[model samples]
Target: MTVPVSPRHDETFVLNLGPQHPATHGVLRVKLTMDGEYIVKAEPVLGYIHRMHEKLAEASTFAQFMPNTARMDYLHALAFNHGWALVVEKAAGIEVPERAEYIRVITVELNRIASHLLWWAAFLLDLGGFTPLLYAFDDREKIIDLLERITGSRLTYCYMRFGGVYNDIDDEFIKGTRDFIKRLRGRMPRLYHDLVTHNIILIKRIKDIGIISAEQCRRYGATGPVARGSGIDYDVRKHEPYSVYPEFDFDVPVFNEGDSMARYMVRMHEMEQSMRIIEQALDKLPEGPVMAKVPKVLKPGAGYYYSAVETARGSLGHRLVCNGDKNPYKLKLRSPTFSNLSLYGEVAEGMLLADALALMGSLDLVIPEIDR
Candidate 1:
């Protein structure tokens, strides 16, 4: 319970909640105006890690810009890769092979699980629970290993190409993925939910804290778990129906409470849904060539094209302007975290300092994506 404080306007002090704080997850700083233990205002300071990604996109060719997408959201790089590939394909009128589409779904889902595991570990660490981090990382490593076997990089993967993917998944990769899925399914109920999610302390810390209404989510254009937690059933994969997502049957986890715990629970349930997608994709995996045949110098006819993908964070969109050239005339990236963070100033007002950080953690921000 928050006790009301009667203080003069002059009594407030400014606090910088880090461009270096561990709880921030990356180079993000919140300028907090405080009146005793309560927050007066919270403004997020961005561009500490900006890499000029959009400008780089303009300069590089369609193929050259593929690696740049991975750097924006390092945790779920494949989603960025998919968004770029999709926009290019949409503009160039390239048709992907059936087998490649399944591969894309499988790999992207695995990346989503890895991204969530890291967020889970880090969010628990923010709330002063260290044990969950150990278990989460232990599980995340298995995904990294599986992805590394095919993608060739551990962290920022540039796997997806313009039409399909760069390579194919072998039987060993298939078997490893199935075994990991079974292992995580057996462990989540006991190790994750029982050990952490239903804990009394966690509930107390987040259950009614950082309330974001459904209206506020819409106002801020918040997507993924943040919007779903606030009772918005808008998912790019489902609503827009991209790639092979139409074939899969999975529920978009939603919680109407709209608190920090609600946001946390949405992500927890989403991991299960992602697993379901991967399993279905694997079972229905078609046999054929992975990459599509293309011209030596690619050029989409002069026009504009756009594509959006549901990443671990939220909806990542790629808008491209082509002038019948190999290079994109203009490239605009709409990163979800940028819009999500815009609501912090409104949400953090009057919150306790500790609770505000908890609220920020629940947003699961990746600074590079926002800064880019």
Candidate 2:
């Protein structure tokens, strides 16, 4: 049995939070030590929903592993899918066609916007506000619709090919995306910022609560907005530019506040940056073969390969060891949520139950991604 940390010099109460709580956003069990309603310490106990995705990936061929990507981060399946595809492409020196690269950027950016929107909704809902949930879904639904036309699925899409995308985008898809970006950009200020960012209650709830400093972030291996919130000045998209990210013009938002509000601001700014990337991708759209010329039977040389991509949650890495055989010998996923969740125990200390919940929300953990 693990001993609970006492918030005070003496006298401490142990609080059992959920494997069923709404604030957790998934089936997460947190052991919290409390001094009244304020959390003295927080510990996350995982594996309730673990599917052994790494084990499953090792049993599948290079071509077959793409579907498993979606199962990890269902909210941002395309980003996960792209990460897997890019790694395989890089390992075998397979070149993706120009048009395919452009399509990949567009779809991934759209999915990113959707993931951030969902986080905004859930984060607000966790803080006792309900309207943002519906508003976020309204915008997210547009992206889902635009992607479903080609991907043939919404939640868990298997749309990416090894060296390219599975299908070519049409005029209707491009036009729909243009309209969606415009509508979302116009509404975000009114619906998200004015209604939530400036709300006195939200400000009081998150401003200085559940803080994590720059040093603590380094200790915890934090990445993405969580690291950026502490002024880390690191974004995998920029540090390790992949896909068409090198061609895009956007800024990685950073903040030095190192609190829940800073994390929230980072995500909001990222959404704007994602919109900018989408508009540029749409305008610079090219035409060519969407599918690359790949072999019917892939036998990559036995070697270890590591690839990382910036998901909406953070940096997602896939490490694989192939044996020049039909299937992967070993596979490992370095999920952003895994690193982000590690900071929860340290940061949630001395925070109220509501503040802890908000802090977890700001981390933007998709439990499936972590547990996988």
Taken over the whole model, the C-alpha lDDT of each candidate is: 0.92, 0.88
Count the clashes in each prediction: 0, 0
Query: Once superposed on the true structure, which residue ranges of model 2 sit more than 4 Å away at CA?
Result: 1-10
| lDDT (10s digit) by residue, model 2, range 139-193 | 9999999999989999899999987999999989989998998898899788888
Candidate 1 off by > 4 Å: 1-7
For candidate 1, write residues 1-372 as lDDT tens digits.
334455468899999999999989899999988998898878999999998988897788899999999999999999999999899999999999999999999999999999999999999999999999999999999999999999999999999987789989999999999999999999999999999998999999999899899999998999989999999998999999889999999999989999999999999999999999999999999999999997756899999788999999899988889999888999989999999989988988888999988999999999999999
Report the CA-based lDDT of candidate 1 relative to the real structure: 0.92
Report per-prediction Cα RMSD to one decimal: 1.1, 2.7
Candidate with maximal lDDT: 1
Please give the range of 10 consecutive residues that has the lowest summed lDDT in model 2. 1-10
